[model samples]
Target chain A: MTVVIGFEGSANKIGIGIIRDGEVLSNPRRTYITPPGEGFQPSDTARHHRSVILTVLKEALEQAGLKSSDIDCVAYTKGPGMGAPLVTVALVARTVAQLWGKPLVGVNHCIGHIEMGRLITKANNPTVLYVSGGNTQVIAYSERRYRIFGETIDIAVGNCLDRFARVIKISNDPSPGYNIEQMAKKGSQYVELPYTVKGMDVSFSGILSYIEEAANKMLGSRQCTAEDLCFSLQETVFAMLVEITERAMAHCSSQEVLIVGGVGCNLRLQEMMGVMCKERGAKLFATDERFCIDNGAMIAQAGWEMFRSGQVTELEDSWITQRYRTDEVEVTWRD
Target chain B: MTVLKRLGRRRLPIANKMAVPENDDQASKLEFSLDVPFPSARQAAVALGSLSPDREPRRGGVHKRLTLTGSVLNVKWRADEARVLRVSVNSFLDHLSLVLETMHAFSADVCEDPHVVLGHQPPSAT
Candidate 1:
């Protein structure tokens, strides 16, 4: 039984998980809520990560009933996060590996979500629709590569949700996406918002501006409630995503669809995707919050696969990269 | 008190400007021109040292007007410390403005021990 510890400090959450032989022993997660009145700031995020990451890691280890020495390998989300936050987690993971003399595996966050979906749903092959605060893409496995068939050209899907929440003055408690979903459910009418899609690439910046303008106007006139606008926004945006996912599935000739990322936790979006998948005879799989949102368990799972293949990062090779393209990682799978 | 060593002068193009006001709607906007090369942080500190009063630094925001035209580096002083700096850029003007504003807010409380050089090369002779 190989014990691998995984560290996830990407974005707003800090997750630590312990895995043994492809099975998760403990999935412990901690999320830092940004202080009211302030959005996501790099300095604040880094400070939060420093304070809570160690506690969460300890919790996972204690729950797994394992010591640091019991862990044979360690893994961490390497990049695609705020520079300061990424540095904090990377340093911690590197220090742990050095102290224990264990090999370090730097996992790609996007691929972690994809692998977690596969593990949870037991899907052999599926078209992946990845949507989150920092990423939006329609991916399919082909030629040993997860090709990006469609994606947002500008701001990510979850980012748009968060920004819209801010515009409508929604309490970002629990999670912004959850709050938005709640508001959307309360809303009844569909407000005509900007619908801009260019080929396989989409732009949300313009739509965000439009919603802000409309919401401000409504606030000025006291015409529509915040929930109505939230509902309209979700309908418009999720429809776009569903449409693209369907197109990508048809294009790839894949009958299975997997939705993974922070936004995958949104039940309404999941329902929409489920409907689309059902009509097309393609199955839609979404991971639970344990793996859907940023969590360490998925990282450990992916790291175990990489570790068995002799893929590890050396101390000299340790450097925090802010922008790591998803396609850059060479997927090494063991039969 | 140990006299701080002075580094030579270096100039960098002030590429963009960002404004952060106490209120959401109100903002102070400044422009940057390509013709003028702004003094590096080291040179700026040296120049400020020479120009400012020798008395112990007071606890307040410093409002100093720049001598250059078409562009000026807008520095906001709060509680006797330089809180924010904005540089203007031509490309992606709005995004750059937001980025600079964020950078300013991030560095507000960071300025300390002005005598310590913060990795800026000195300004060269024009």
Candidate 2:
């Protein structure tokens, strides 16, 4: 079996991981945290990756109890992320491959998450719910491709939640989403928020706009608790996601739903998805923070699959992209 | 060829057009280049890595590439107008500044070599 080490810095999180066969040996990650009322900036995020990448790599190697020469190949997140952060990680990965005389494989960020979830949870051909700060899509495997049945036409769901957290000036230490999820549990009232799902696609900007207005009113007259708004936002957005995912499942005739991404770690989203899955007589597959949140082991796992399939990126052709799509990659490992 | 005046006394040739446009219908093709040197070849590679997302096609018909040869980082920009080339170059320089500053700020924390040239140094005349 081939041993691969992966680097992932698609956004604020910089991760380094090692994988052997289908087993992830080590996954170490660091996230860039901004002050209250501020969202992540690409430049700052890129800088964070550049500064901490090596330290993270060392930690991963130590955790895996492997030397640099033990690795057979290097893999890195190639795209579908913020441009600067993606490049910063790719550079280190490329340099490491060159230094260690190993093969390099550039991986799609979204596909990495999907494949790792499948591997860890042993889900086969499930309808996938991939959600993160920069992406929201309901995908299913068809004809050797992860075809997108639905996605956000505007901002992603995580972006909506993050921005809402910012509007309310929440601490971004652990994560805005986690804090919001906690607040949502304490909420008893349901505030009406706009829910927009167009055909198979979803839109979150309108909901964000409505919440921003509500937040303004909250700031003006102190009429509502932020917990109530968080509750309403989570309930509304998760419902829309479930609705589109259910539609995609019906379209694909798939009975399993897989949630994989940063937002997948939220227990409330999982409960809502689990309820929906039970109602439809389907199964739900999900992963924890180790496999979900932009980690390198996912890239390593995906890269191992690509390597086994004889996909090696030549040094000259190892280019990074900002808009690499999930469907653009040929899923050679899957039938 | 439309040659914009040099910036700085080093006379570092920035951009030059091939056959200046005679009219609005005829587009001028200009290529500009800036070579940045880091304290180490690895740092140059880091700078090149931070530009991975630039593989996507840019608007206004501007083309750019960032490559590293040893400790030198090379950035090339091609556009139809001197204005477009300037804008692209300026934007890239701003990003490079941020990347370099970050490298400087966090280099000690990451790199074992304290003397590594992670900070922004002035471009040389060579």
| Native contacts kept, each candidate | 0.00, 0.06
- lDDT by residue (tens digit), candidate 1, A17-113: 9999878889898777864434788767767876676668778888998877689898888878886677667666765564355888888888888
lDDT of 2 by residue, A191-262 (tens): 898889999999999999999999898747867788888999999999999999999999988999999998
Query: Model 1 segments beyond 4 Å from truth?
Result: B1-126
Per-candidate RMSD vs. true structure?
14.3, 6.8
The prediction achieving the highest DockQ against the true structure is 2
Q: For residues B1-126, what per-residue lDDT tens digits would candidate 2 score against the true structure?
A: 011121222234443334444445554567677776555677667667654444535567788877777877777776777887776776566556545544544454434335443433454722
Clashing residue pairs for model 2: A87-B49, B39-B117
Superposition error at A211 for model 2 (Å): 0.9
As a TM-score, model 2 comes out at 0.80
In angstroms, the error of model 1 at A183 is: 1.2
CAPRI quality of model 1: incorrect
